[model samples]
Target chain A: MNVVEVTNICKTYPAFFLNRVSFSLEGGKITGFIGRNGAGKTTTIKSMLNLVHTDSGEIAYFGMPLIGHETEIKQRIGYSTGTISWYPRKTIHEIVDVTKTFYTHWDEEAYRRYMTLFNLDESKKPIELSEGMKVKFNLLLALSHGAEVLILDEPTSGLDPFSRDELLELFTTLKEHGVTILFSTHITSDLERCADNIIYISHGEIRAACSKDEFMENYGQPGDTLEEIFLRQEREERK
Target chain B: MNALLKKEMRLSAMLLTYLFIGFGLMALLPGYPILCGVFFITLGIYQSFQNAREANDILYSTLLPVAKRDVVKGKYQFVILIELCGFTVMAMMTILRMTILADSPVYRQNVLMNANPFFLGMVLLIFGLFNVIFLGGFFKTAYSIGKPFLIYIFAAFLTIGLAETLHHIPGLSALNAFGFDHIVLQISLFLCGILIYAALTWLSYRKACTDFDKIDL
Candidate 1:
């Protein structure tokens, strides 16, 4: 069963439009939503979550339309963006307290574990945290709610190599527990490491959707990586 | 909806605290009840818009597990909660003044002003206008707080000035002179204020929710 299915989603802006974007993520799998900046990855993600109103199309989560089932679907799915800005004056404890009230399956123990694991001080205000800490705090919020599907935008954009590796490890652990993850990131290395499926978006339209192994089999030699295939595809599209 | 309201309240704690302090200070001044009404109307408009901007509230709220409509509803609920708090505090101070400070100069000055239903109704109408214009203008451009705030400031001053003038006109002056002593007039004025407030509350919410639904964020 697919966890999420987006079909024919379109949104028009003065500078760009997400034209007929469509894709599906299988249940219990990690899918890397890959694209360059201004390539409509974020727009597609926003439309899927109903954060951005689309001109036309449908988005389904767990086999139901997203419009009417937003609250239910959101309760099951966790979303984290690159810049997670809330009330800066609020303490971590206050933020967590407020956020946990929204979910029925919120795991208090899980919240505590992640807070401890990240060395997050509950008493500290959000503004006192570093950019990396802020991302981790967002991740902690996403994970603590017992969310079945995690949708992240640019999750690894500002982290160091060690933290990036840690995040990938966390993704692997989440996949083991049958939690589906759809993360968009510019860093191809992270996707290559754990993504079972890949969806490439370019210029507000989907260019490719296939398993990483299948992509490698078709476009790569024995040693050519995901980056090379992406570069090749970019070059071909420009022709 | 409760979850969103809870979060919004926490986000607005600082503003609420400031409003409380302002109310407390007003309690000591002559004609404090009239000041209370103006203070809440101005502060409600100013703080709601200011807090939303400073907190980057739209982005934060949209990311939450809430429907767009619920977010709008939660905001209205927050404003109503603040107004309730303001009214309660002002009423309590009024009662205390009447009972304990009957001979006090400040109490004597404000006693005839806000004690009447007509004055209360006028205050309600002014507050209603503020809500209608501010919330209606806000959801049109979710991020543009300045335009709405400026518009409300201009509207509020014009309204209070007009109301003051109308209160002194010979025909309306009879009603003001009768004041709270005339039970029938008081009840009628109170009912009128309440009806206007309720109608504007409904209109503002409907308009804000409609405007918010169309926002792309």
Candidate 2:
């Protein structure tokens, strides 16, 4: 069963347009949503989450429409953006205190565990944290709630290598626990490491969506890395 | 809804603090009532403009487990709460000042300036118009605040200016004096202001929900 099913979603901006994009994520699988800058990756993700209104399309979670079931769907799906700027003056503890009120299934013990694991300072406000720390805090909030599907947009953009690896491992553990993930990033190495599926988008259109093994088989030669495949795809698309 | 309101309160607590201080100061001035009213409405508009500039509310609230409509509802509730608090604070401070100056007719004269029901009604009308225009323009796109903020400010100043000028005219001044004498007329005008406030609150919420739903974050 698919965790998320997006069908023919279209959104138009003055300078860009996402034209009839469609993709589906299988349950308990990690799908890498790949696109370069100016490639409508964020727009597509935001559309799926209904953060952005689409011009035309249907998005569903667990076979229910996103429009009518937005509150329910969002409750079960945790989302994190690349830039994590909440109330600048709010401390981490205050933020968590306020945030936990929205979710009926909030796990305070899991929240404390993630805070300790991430070494987040509860007394510090968001503005006091470095970009990487902010990202970690956001990830903690996302994980604290019993979210079944995590829609993370560039969740590791600013993390150190060790922390990034730790987060990647955490994603694997989540998958093992039957939680699906739709990870968006331009970093191909992260995708190569753990993604079971890849959804490539370019110029506001979906270029390809398939399993990582099939992606590598179709595009890679012996000793060719995921980065090489991404570069080759970029070069091919330019032509 | 409670969750959203809690977040908004936390986010805007500093603004509310500043407003409380500003209103407290306004009540001590000789031109207390009208200036207090002006400050009250301006504070609301200014804080909303500031929120739009920050854009953090949109970022955080949209990520939460609430519908777009609830966000709008929560925002309207927040604004109304702030306005009511401002009104209460200013009213209390003004009344306290009035009590302190009971021995001085000159001070009482100053207190009576713009203290009539017609003037109070105009203040309410200005606030109601500001909300209708501001929230209507704001939620239409929910992106840029400059255009909407400027549009509402222009309308607000012009309306307030015209209302004040109209109040000074000979015929209206007579009506104002008449309203000041008759308790029933004064009560009726105050009730009219309340009615407009209630209608605008509902209208603003409805408009905000509609406009917010169409917004692309």
Candidate 3:
């Protein structure tokens, strides 16, 4: 079953337009949503989650539209836009404790597991954490609610090599547990590490959307790395 | 709804509660516009917006397991809750002044707004305008706070100046009446103030919720 399906979503700004963007995340698989910074990856993700209002679209989780089911859908879908900018003065324990109150199926076990794995200090405020720790904390909040699907935007952008590898490994582990993930990033190497599927976007349009092997096979020479395929595709678009 | 409001209070409005508590005592001042007390209370509430913006609260909150409208509802509820708490303290002080200090020269000879039903009425009016002007302006963009609040400040002081002078106008001296001097009229105006505050605030809450619904966050 598709965990999330975004169909014909569109948004427009004074300078940019996301044209009829559409994709879906298969249940329990990691789909890397890849694009350059301004190629509408964040805009598309936000549109999917209704964080960015769509000019026209239908977004469904478990086949229900987002408009009326925001609370229930959000409870089941973990979303981290790769930033923890709220409650800078409050402790992690304080923010997470309060956040858990909003979810019906909060998993204490998951919370503790991430807390231990990330080596997070609950007493420390967000300002006190390293950039890596803040991202881990953002993921912890997303996962603590027993979310069936996790949509992370640029989850590894600011990480050290070791931390990035750790997160990619965790994404693989999460996939094995049947947690569907849509991981958005420009970091192709991180995607190469674990993503089973690829959704390539360029110039605010989808360039490639397929299984990882098929995406490589269809878009570029068979042995090309994901980064090579992306550069080639972007070069073609600029032609 | 309870969860959202709780979060707003615990995280968003934490330190600001002391502002509400302390400013209500501004009602006890012997000779001040006293309406300016209401302005300061509104300013205190404005500080919550500053903190929320700095923390990017609207972004985090939209991701929570609550409807987006509920987020706005939570904010409005918390703001009104703080206002009500301050109003309660102000009311207690007003009652004490109306009774114990009824004939005290310190209050009687005071040349500014008195703590009375009429004063309380204007307080509600100022609060009502805060909701309409500030909150209504805020959710239109969901991020900009300065211009809207500046507009509110202007409206607030204008209302304050008008309120202070109303009692001095011919046949309107009853507005500044001392110790039940015009108890019936004062009480009626106070009731009208209550109705106006409730109506205006509820309308502003609805408008804020609507504006927030269209925001991209």
Candidate 4:
């Protein structure tokens, strides 16, 4: 069964518009939401989460609608944002304790493991931590929730090479456990390394979506990287 | 709700401490312990307003599974909690001042003026008015990106007008009809204010939740 199904979603603003966007994520797989800035990736994710109201469309988590079933859907879906701003005075432990109260399936062991792996200081205030550490803390929170689906937006934006590699390994492990993962990022390399499927969005529309190997085979040239393919697709769309 | 309340209390603890100090200072100035009460009450209202702003944890909070209504209710609960703590400190200071300056001739007159039923009523009225203004202003500001100060000013005027008119009505004037000698009356008025605040808080929560549902995020 599809873990998430988004159909014909549309949202319009003065300068930007998302037109009839559609996508789905199945169990035990990873899907990459690939798009440049202003391509409506975040908007689509927000709509799926019911954080952004769509003008038209249907979104389902499992089989229930996202609107009235938000709390239930969110319980099973761990989410992380690109910019993780937290309460300045709260320490990581305090945040973890608070989050634990909300999720019934919270995995304390997983939380402890992530803390050890990331070298996160539980006693330090969120404001006192570095940007990468903040992201790591957020990732830990999202992962330790024991969620069936993980919706991460730009999870590798500011990480160093080592941290990024560590995160990729973590994702591999999560996938091995049969957890569905949907993440949006501008870093095509991360998608190439970890993503099983790609949903390429351009100008608020889905340009192409298929397995990574199939996408590479169809559009990728000899010595052509994913970045080259993305740029080429974007350039072609503009023309 | 617990998380939101803890976060708000931690951030507003300093403001609450300052309010206590202000009440203590007000009590020493003379016969009018009621003036001290009024001063502390207004300060408490202002603190609630400030706390509301400081509790804007939208980015992280929106990710949580809780409904938006619960988030708004948590904020109102925080404001009420702060107000109650401030009121308690102010009441203690008032009693202490009353005892200390009981025999002072100069303060005797001041005390009478401060303790007048009308004066106390007006203070309560103003506080209720401020609560409405603060909630409305915060909601208006959250909906748009324009000048919130102007929206606050407008909300203040609207709240003042509505509260004053409501208090002037025959039946609803019970809010201002507290008799200092009658403990029951005082308790009833206090309860009435709390009930009104609770109702408005629920309404505000509903408004916020519906607005969030309609918002583009």
Alpha carbon lDDT of each predicted model: 0.77, 0.77, 0.87, 0.68
Query: Which is the better candidate, 2 or 3, if ranked by DockQ?
Result: 3
Write down the C-alpha DockQ for each prediction: 0.64, 0.62, 0.79, 0.40
Instruction: State which candidate has the highest TM-score.
Output: 3
Candidate whose DockQ is highest: 3
Model 1 lDDT tens row, B1-217: 5788888777644665445534533443564336446555456546655766676777777777888888888877876666656555555654555456656664444433444456556667766776787766787877776787678778876766665566456766544433234658766976897798789988999989888888887
Q: Write the per-residue lDDT of candidate 4 for residues B171-203, one digit (tens) a residue.
A: 654433322434465466546655665566556
What is candidate 3's CA lDDT for residue A80?
Answer: 79
Write candidate 2's Cα lDDT for B63-168 as tens digits.
7889888887776777676666655555565445435543445444552344445545655666676677766667787666667678867776786567546646
Off by over 4 Å in 2: B16-18, B21-28, B31-33, B48-52, B93-104, B107-112, B174-180
Candidate ranking under TM-score, highest first, comes to 3, 1, 2, 4
**What is the Cα-based TM-score of model 4?**
0.82
- Quote model 3's TM-score for chain B: 0.96
Q: Against the native chain B, what TM-score does each candidate's chain B reach?
A: 0.81, 0.79, 0.96, 0.58
The residue pairs in collision within model 2 are none
TM-score, every prediction: 0.92, 0.91, 0.98, 0.82
User: Can you tell me which runs of candidate 1 are displaced by over 4 Å?
Assistant: B15-18, B21-28, B31-37, B93-115
Candidate 3 C-alpha lDDT tens digits along B1-217: 5888888877887586556566877788888878787887888889888888888788888888888888889888888987888888899889988999789898899888889998898889999999999988999998999999999999999999999888778988889988888899999999999999999999999998888988886
Winner on lDDT (2 vs 3): 3
